[model samples]
Target: MLPDLAAMSSTSFQITATTGAFPLEAGTIFTNTVEVNTTLLGDDPSNNVAETAATVFPLLYIHEIQGSGDSNTMPGAIVNIEAIVVGDFQDNDGDLFDTDLDGFYVQEELADYDNDKSTSEGLFVYAPGATDVAVGDLVCLTGEVGEYSDQTQLTLQGDLKICGHATLPAPVSLTLPVRDISDFERYEGMLVSFPQALVISEYYNYDRYNEVVLAEPFVDERPFQPSAYLDPTTEADAIDDAASLIARSRITLDDARSAQNPPLLRHPNGAPYALDNRFRGGDMVQDATGVLGQGFGIYRLQPTVAATYIEENPRPDASPAVGGSVQVGAFNVLNYFLTLDDGSDICGPNLDMECRGADTPQEFDRQRAKILAALEEIEADVFGLVELENTTGVTPTADLVAGLNDTLGAGTYAHIETGTIGGDAIKVGLIYKASTVTPLGDFVVLDDPAFLDPNNTGVPKNRAALVQTFQDNRSGETFTVVVNHLKSKGSDCGGAPDDDPVQGNCNLTRAMAADYLVDWLSTNPTGTGTGNNLIIGDLNAYDK
Candidate 1:
């Protein structure tokens, strides 16, 4: 017995005993059992000996063909490989049948058969629109190893055989807070279970793709520090931590159901998990057993079993009205518009594509329902509304008022009309319960330097604030309420001098607007001759 050749390349090797001292006939084949060592010197010497016939074709494992290289492409030709089907898209035993990531991922049955952590034991089968196989089926396949996008997957060649059903491998236990980008490759296509519950942080793509981003905890983060510390290092560190948490601690949960906006959503208990109308950002989830999949630059947890959902944030009831004779309120109505979302220029000065509200009448109806609910719940006598669609009509503000009053009664709520103020598609308006308060005069809107421009933000740096005097019908008490939505820090007046090193975008404009607000409020802009005022609105330029 000798030593192992660094390692054996094939399953079988042969040796001949045609010694140098003796010559054999041309037709003679060596019959001597020339022993070969298949182990290292450190290994047992007696157990190292081997005798076998060399073969033309050799069996290859999935990892051997996959190799350990990080590059997408495999260098050598791969004849064939075998693995059990951990994923073949047959997991849908019931109505749920979603496989949006496409392609099945096959992995070796036993855990770490070759004991090489550097190489992956699993490989994705990139045969799209082909789904004849079932999960847990053992398979032997011949394929051309090419990378589809960045994923190293096998494009099936010749005829593949599903040997039979077998016990699927146990799922790998993986936890969250994946700090590095490359940490997910090992678990790709492998059955994995999250160790702890993940909260649903984003559901904007819920209806579109049945996709939800889940984090270990809530991620509805606020931008700026509440205290005015203004420390650069602290701010940078906080921002970095926040950014990392957003990217690192999330897994995209893809629904197994092929349907969109399924009528019945349930918890793991098989009861309704109804967190608000849809699963909002704070809903907790657990018992998510899924195949880790990647496509289009997103890693999706394709659930083998439906994930258990806990309604962390339930549907909120209407807010209790504050006990006051003059009930003044401020509401941000996230851009309410009446023009049937035809994408025509709602605001004359803005581009037609600037339409940001509901894209359809049905959508508008849905949005109107929510706004109506919110306002009616507030039950405020005086309401200063912000972010209404800027358009000129006989009653541009009437649509919302009509929608509100329809819910609260025909004569319940009415809003002040300013026609069209600025060119931008969003503006502020005033609304009040007619039974509770009366409008003394017309709603006043300003486009001056203080209200609109600061650091010369090219016209309206701030939304045109509307000032209107409301008289308490019973007590004859009159006060002013101005609704102002200032320039937001995001993409605000983004020119050279306007950008602040510490305060960031549009801070100067907001400061100037504040100064102008104080001076203008001193004079009583609406001029009921009343100094008693309630000036409340969002100063958006202060945050990241």
Candidate 2:
């Protein structure tokens, strides 16, 4: 129906209306018409009326919302949308409100024939309530278009109908060995599968963040003093390429679980995700399928299935006779402080200052258990441990030894009494199997002459050098076991300070510690002064 233009006296006019609930779903199309001046014909009847055909887009295609131009959201358009479920936040349990993940993601079922790979084909459906949608379901939903948390998503408004079940589109194959977010921009919100197998190089924030760094090869720490050419242009380009390399080649696999420290990481056989230690950096996974996503300042692969990880890198037993008859081993405990982050002040050190290991009691227990399990697998008779609390009492070191020996049999192990050799929050510890070897002489610790002054501290700066002599019973050979924890290149030991090429804070201090170690060892710091010495610990320096 049209209002006569005679009253307004205009040759042209426009009409708008709020239509009834839409009965048609996505992919359905038909034509209709519009007419003018039906009641009376004008003087020129040929120009008095006309009919124009229109085809309804029941739901806007993902490409329409994600414009092919640039990174910008579609301003205002409330329309229906259709996509298949790819990333569901809801686990087997129907609970949804208990997590920070308030939405599931949907990706286009098929790639457009003319797609230029410029825009995302997937969109997150922001559903904070009970959800009827599941993975592999093709759904037609009417929702208000908007961006939440800087991500393009929809808020369901009217109907959410699961039309039917269909086979999901063949996943877009992805490969590693590159590092750019733009490479993934076009594939974002689309079902993507990787070709090369990837190792879970590291857990995202100790497994609580629910993500893993997947790389074609192993992930290594950035060098403290990165080598660069004098040519600024080449250096700048290399730096940029290096920066992009990580994001391009390595994809973060985000777990669908929303809880902190979930216990669901299991092996293919349904056991916990570790022989000891949660998926030791080299644990591998293959051909993962998920919706490529970007959020919270990170790009992620939200897997369609969380527990289907194939262990390409399985745990192996350590080789015996690693060294002499003692089988000595070196380990970086990753700040194995005995402190608990229990709310009460009674628990040792807090996470803020002296605390490094675990925060809560439960976290502490779990962390310690994992560490012990990992150590048990090492099966080392003598362990040179770094990142341990340098406290005088055995509250920290003795507790760890007792725990290890408990699984390894009581009276089997003993920790060296270094007696607070350094002022650093962490230091190296010496623990030996009492049955396999005997502590021959007193252990020696060299605190820096001035406790490490500025200018790379001249001395050790942070942790001190711990040296001991152990007698291997079978071979009857005594070797000097030197455990050293040097100044790390992390934190803010920058130009006002260390002035390192890489962001790893203190390069000079660690260098000075090595020099000091050489000088002191020549003098035989241990009473026995055995030339047969095995010097090991995290010196905070890389050979490459």
Candidate 3:
């Protein structure tokens, strides 16, 4: 209500009212009218009433919307803000579908920053069709705040207005090995730079997602496999702690593209990551700068500028020399099954188990070629193999030996024939170079009840051991080789011996198998009475 005006002179005044919880959706206008009462006389009655219109919404800063927590405060609220574009991932390529995220990132200008460490001043505006904006452009837009895949974002509801251009904000500097894994949440969707040299720790997703994990090198050395250093049974807590440290120290370096198996891969040095120019796990990337983003439960750095890549860890051309009269080696031939994994259940000994490994003829050819090259390079006299298909017909071991002989003359290599040693879908195998070593008496197999499941059934849980004695041609020295495949930690056992946080699942079962092996070998199971023994193959347990 307006105050009464004196006689013929009129004065303007102000009114403050709250538009509590405007219920309409975004872009809707709310109007208000003011009228003069009968007590207040007006010269013209027609001019007594006046109305004003406004798009009912709050105008908030980026920090206010992001809040000081992991999520947004006004998630479903419609609001307006003006900020400068930081990183633009809009689909500029004329593809039918977006190759990257069809949106852009905007951050508050340095002058307008709220100066709050806990709240982020940058935000991702999910405008898939936006076209008129670029980096450093000051733009005002009305949008509804929302959470997409645990990330706070904005969806445009009204026309975005481009104000004048502004200077780009400086990116915040950060270091690896943060105190906690959640420490990255504060800088989510913001521009950040790492001033120190970081090493590539893992590239498991590089082939598929154009991404590689970067982390602070472990004590200035390459990251070692946890299982190689710590015992999963005794040092379980330490192993878990080391894993947490890795999680806190690492961040994914993405190509800023969303396409899988990109035709042209990108490297930090502005070069294509090709077969010749590849990056290993220990390569270093210096002074990396990018926009930090969270998606699919991973924190990634979408590079904004090219960085220097140092090839500190080059690919090894040949295997290291061990220097001995006879060389013995072990390899895990991961699911080397001739039976195709083509949605059929006609593999294994019973002919009813599902097959694994290559799914097509083309894939099988590629797999065989790589395996053959690796085996030839090892140059070992005797090799213990794991994960071979447990089928009755032409075995994987026979196929591998044939491929080897084709490369290195005929009668060069031979494989032991113990038909389908166990009931499991996969079994262990042994192969040797016939020219270097000769087989002794019949190969022995430890197929005791200890390998069976805890229910005392005939079904074996661990694959039976493949034991053989070999005599070196030059030295005439005999050594018994025992190959084994123990129960893995991937699944659980029933009851009190299920799984240990320290050693993982099936710890007791594997321990029991180890005990049985020691007892069986003590009884001279091979009957060669050779005290010289060598135990090998996938024990499925980590070394201390």
Candidate 4:
């Protein structure tokens, strides 16, 4: 029978070490030792307590202590121990055995026994009710030391131990905003920051009643510099004022990096202003406060100081009397075609008498009769007709001019033909009285490159503008007349999905032609430099 085992109480323990005995008094931490053991040494009867008593002691170490009450009610001490083997024990298979057997055993001598191995010296005790513990934490345990065959162990009785607090790590810093154009001044020639928002408060009377209110952010700004001036103002004064402001504000870098240039400010109302192109119309100069408000705004300015004095020079006067009163009429005569078989038939071979069929003799007579009557009533000095066709190709347009002049009796009319490549079958024609307004020469044809192909072709193959210089009968003053026919409704040649460009083709073409005419008129001054230039034709473009 086994000796009566002693009952252990819950208490704390102190730990000390000796070569032959367990050094822990009451409470100390317990850790796993003799890591290679396959079974609990104290429970194996084959290697009983008597066998362990004769074995040499193993090394033991205290790691923690445990207790439930005062020191007097201490449970036991927990210590980790390792055994020393004289020779290896053998199994039936002849494999060498190196672990604990069973029963009470003496502790082995302490030595550095492979501390790197986690199962050996590295083993730790986890506290009771605690989730986890780190490598270096000092733990305490309460238990009794016992031994099996070749190993020493601890018998745990009560609660285990733990430390309260945990180790933690340090906290982290955050960056700031930068300055841009909004923080600087905005003005032409001045270093001022560009206007973040250019607001157009009012756009007064543009194109008579059409007004446009507008605003935009200042995308560009520069320093102002001048070269020369024109008649009215000196370039030096303008440059001085501009340079002073520019020096105070930031100077804009030149586009080519060649020189210092002033910024250009475009007004919402179609006016452009810059230090170089400064005139008085739509740009503002700031007061001492650097605020640009209303009043005589600069329209255009030149960079060279010498360019500032350039003025609109006046022209010399000339002769007044002689030419007859000229009346110009623009008519879209629908369709006027001469017959191929008989010259007398106006509507040609297939039309009906009522001007409804493809071409007929009676229809020709009816149209001609009406045209003659209208001509007699208006007594037009010049006529512009559209949609005139001929059988011989060139004959019809000439015939109409001849027929009208003959019918009128006194007026001598001539048809100005536009030399279009394959458009002789039907074309836009001009007829004018030679006696009232002498033709300054021949007709000038305007060419349009936009409608060079069929997909862009429709009512008008391509746009053409006719320019004729005529001597006005009443003033003897020569006047320039321009007749234009622009593009018509059709599919867009631009290959756009909606065909929006072709839908507005006529208007766009007409506007372009008008712009060309304006440019020409500005350059060409006629008849004492005061004669009127009239643009009369079936423009086919709405004014809007």
Candidate 5:
């Protein structure tokens, strides 16, 4: 009679000992006992299994035949059966499972089969030596426990077979674009480098030449002083190198004495020297000999080197009264050139040196010619000229006035020099004919008095504002004209966005000047009949 298997529950058993080799055949069952732990079956026993492994306490049945040659096993028989571990088994065979085809294995399948089974859980069964058994191959797995190694190892109950080798999904791809740099060609002359950003502080057209110019006044950090150089061999060099030279040297007094004596006099008649003719006003003297001797005491020495000078003289042939209207002309003479065209050999081939090699005679001649031409073009009763230099240390103001009065041969002209600030040689001035407008005297407005320090100061004299007042001779009207050249925006003007109230100190100064002028005008009105008051010059600010 068949052993009664009806009372047996479907259960898992661990092979206590294997009597034969692996790939156990059907009907070849050895004596195997059902484990006391019920968790030895199913995919992930750590998590509660929906169905526990069948219990086979009294006896177990050969319910199904698995593995090679296991099909003939009879059901309900107490067969010492070799079981086939059939289900989803992944091994060396590439047929049963594929990642590209079946997708990834579920996480539950890879978890421990039971809390007590360490090595058996999440372990896949595989047929060794199968083509799909290569390293890096992945496959699905399913099996039964044939033997046990303490609490860790698991042995196959039947033939370990391959389900399939997994195939990896295809890799992903990407793309990116390139950039261009063509527009930077125009900035070639600026001495700029690549991948850099340069911020311009200020840009404007200079009124004289009407040439577009850029200024970065913020760079002016300190006063400009001429660098002193001395030759090592000369006796005068000893004085320059003396230990107490800066303090004990009497260059000013020595300079005065040198001016009194001339080694070679310009006048052949042996006449007494006129100060104006004997020495060019702004010339500086350098003596090689340290001796304070007799001949040097009696006669002045000619200047070894003259100061850098530029001059602008008014047109001698100007006739503004004929037109009955003032025409003002602004020109940048482009260094020291009297004429717009090339004439003298001084400049040679270079365009920058228009009046080169010009002696006093040539300078006078060239200046007269240019002034005549400019006056004819401007035809203004009043004119403003900037960037003028001259020999008298008086600048171009007096010379221009004198020249115009002499050449026009009609009306007398007078001018007042508006001195410089910040050690700049360039000064602005006004030239007008006495026949059209009478000079009413002029005064200078100084920069804030609070900036003056007794210990340290800039450029000797403080920054000042020059204001000149005049009267219209023809109309008998009084006009107060305030001429100004305000501080430029490039320096210490704070930064953007300009709307911020805290920044723009230079703008504040300009505003202060404007307000000061307004207040002055309010206090000192022109004449009774709505006096013709005009405020002019480079205000250095944009009109609101």
Candidate 6:
């Protein structure tokens, strides 16, 4: 206090104290005050006093705050707790969450665990500012409990003090297809290990989200699209029960970051997620250890250790040959619209519906090339295509046929003309090899309003189902091919039985469409009156 500063010079120091020396009890208020007086004129005495206060609260256990349910028990309540850091992800690098989650994960020491199976002992500390804590470091922090995006977190109210280093808790071993979905709640924010081999089930979001769905090896036991198997027309509770099993059997392996389209994407096996080192669906991962986290309404794992990967599902070089005189194929040419999806509404049959395919001619050409390449590989005598533009002249179906004939010889392929079957922006189409198969009768469409829109509002629920009879020139045998593009589960129909968490949206509409299709085919919709009938196309349902 006796040191005097010269002309605008100042000094910095720290005041330290030990709480044990004062014998203060819990719930007690402790305040420290300091004042400065200078002998200079107009020295701004108003800023001379500085004071700080800290209220002592009993140090609570991590499980006490986490409770036994999905949410924190003591939300908004201030607490002082000590734990060992398990995950040190507090760096400001743009890798985690696109720009740092600005926090780290801490869990109660083994000796301090409450030994409760339901309540979790781990917590995420939301410290935007830097902290010198590392994994295995024993630390004490005072913070208020809060929930962020359905995840429980503690916001630091003061400096986090590292007391000493300690051993990390053993990772909790877990397996997929748990008895119940709530089983994951107890392990949230905790270090968990899956010893069983988990198969990569989906990578639809890997390009943008850098995440893949991991599931059990057996498809029957894992979470799958329900409509693919459970015919909604059947009277069974299996559809509703599938949701529970799906929730328990599925979990996502996140890239430990939330960035979209990351420059470098890596799998949990330390392999780059690229075309060369691809981990396609059906690849196996063993010994996956990670911090179980919940975000974006789904539970994901932020890997803590590299897992072992086995390339079990290798890509096939060619389509397998079938035992049939004339080979048939079905494909969904995802929105092969002749017009661009460019903000103007001039693409559909009436030239008033909005477009939904390539945005430019160059993109269309690339898409067309890919489609033609796939078609060449199939080499089927007849093909059923979906998601084609419903325009009037030179429709997408004819354009595709032209592209095929140009690649093959002229008059190699031909398309059936239905003239925009339905009012939807997209429709189904049929094409056959003119050299292998001949069209026997005129094409027919099932536009029964009773089955599509049971309410009878005159509005079609989905694209009309097309039926055509084709004769194999080699055997001179005729068979009717029913091409269907039923209603998708993407959007709801604004009524009951249409939307189910397990079966997805438009279940009733699709079920009715299927029933009506079966009934209409029984009446021999095609004049060929052939008993041999084959239904093929994008049914938009899973084979559960």
RMSD of each candidate relative to the true structure: 11.8, 8.4, 7.3, 35.4, 38.3, 6.6
lDDT of 4 by residue, 1-544 (tens): 3333354232222222332444433433234331112222335556332322211222234211111111111123334332221111111222211111111111112343333211221111222232233222233333354322211234533443434322211100000010222212111111111223222222333222222222221223221132212111345455555434333332111111111221233322223434454332222221111111111221111111011111122222532444546677777665676643342333312222222222557767877777767765666778777655523333555776667767766446776665432232344567777777776665565544432232443444444556667777666777777665544544333433323321244444445556765666655434222446777776654343
Model 1 bad stretches (over 4 Å): 1-99, 111-126, 138-163, 179-181, 201-211, 218-235, 238-247, 256-281, 294-299, 312-335, 342-364, 384-387, 394-396, 446-469, 472-524, 528-544
CA displacement after TM-score superposition, residue 294 of candidate 5 (Å) = 64
Candidate 6's residue-wise lDDT over 1-544, tens digit each? 4345553455543333334322344543322222433333344545443323233454777898899999998778777778888876675644434334577788998887886899998888888785756779998888888998888899987677887999989999999889987788898888888988888888878877788888886553334665467774593577667656666777888876666777678776866766677776788888888778878888778776778888887898866766788889999998998887888988667888888898889989988999998897787889999989887663888888888888888998898988887788888889999999999879998877865675443567767888999999989999999888877787777766676566567766777778778878899988895778898998876654
Candidate no. 2 TM-score = 0.69
- Provide the lowest-lDDT 10-residue window in model 5: 171-180
Give the TM-scores of the predictions, in the order they appear. Answer: 0.66, 0.69, 0.75, 0.33, 0.31, 0.75
What's each prediction's clash count?
0, 8, 0, 81, 24, 6
Predicted candidate 5 versus true structure: per-residue lDDT over 174-220, tens digit per residue = 10000111111111101111111111111122122111111111122
1-544, model 1: which lDDT tens digit per residue?
4445567554543344332322333333222222333443354546656544222122356676566665333533444556788765533333334343445678886853577665667777755455467788887766667765456777765456776777888888878888575677766667888868878777766655667777777444312332243344467665555556556777888764445565555333233435543465687888777777766687777776666777787657755665767777788877777656665654433444356677788888898888888777778888777888776552446877888877778989888878777767777888788998888877777677657876764566687788888888999988888788888877747665566544667877887887888788898777683887777767674433
lDDT of 3: 0.79
Supply the global lDDT for candidate 5: 0.33
Instruction: Give Cα-based local distance difference scores for all models.
Output: 0.67, 0.64, 0.79, 0.37, 0.33, 0.77
Report the C-alpha displacement of residue 265, candidate 6, in angstroms.
5.4
Alpha-carbon runs more than 4 Å astray in model 3:
1-59, 77-104, 124-144, 155-168, 204-211, 223-246, 255-270, 295-298, 315-318, 392-394, 443-465, 485-516, 539-541
Worst 10 residues of 6 by lDDT: 29-38
- Candidate 4 regions exceeding 4 Å error are 1-324, 339-358, 390-393, 410-412, 417-425, 448-461, 490-506, 520-531
| Quality of model 6 by C-alpha lDDT | 0.77
What's the C-alpha lDDT at position 224 in model 3?
A: 66
Q: What TM-score does model 5 achieve against the real structure? A: 0.31
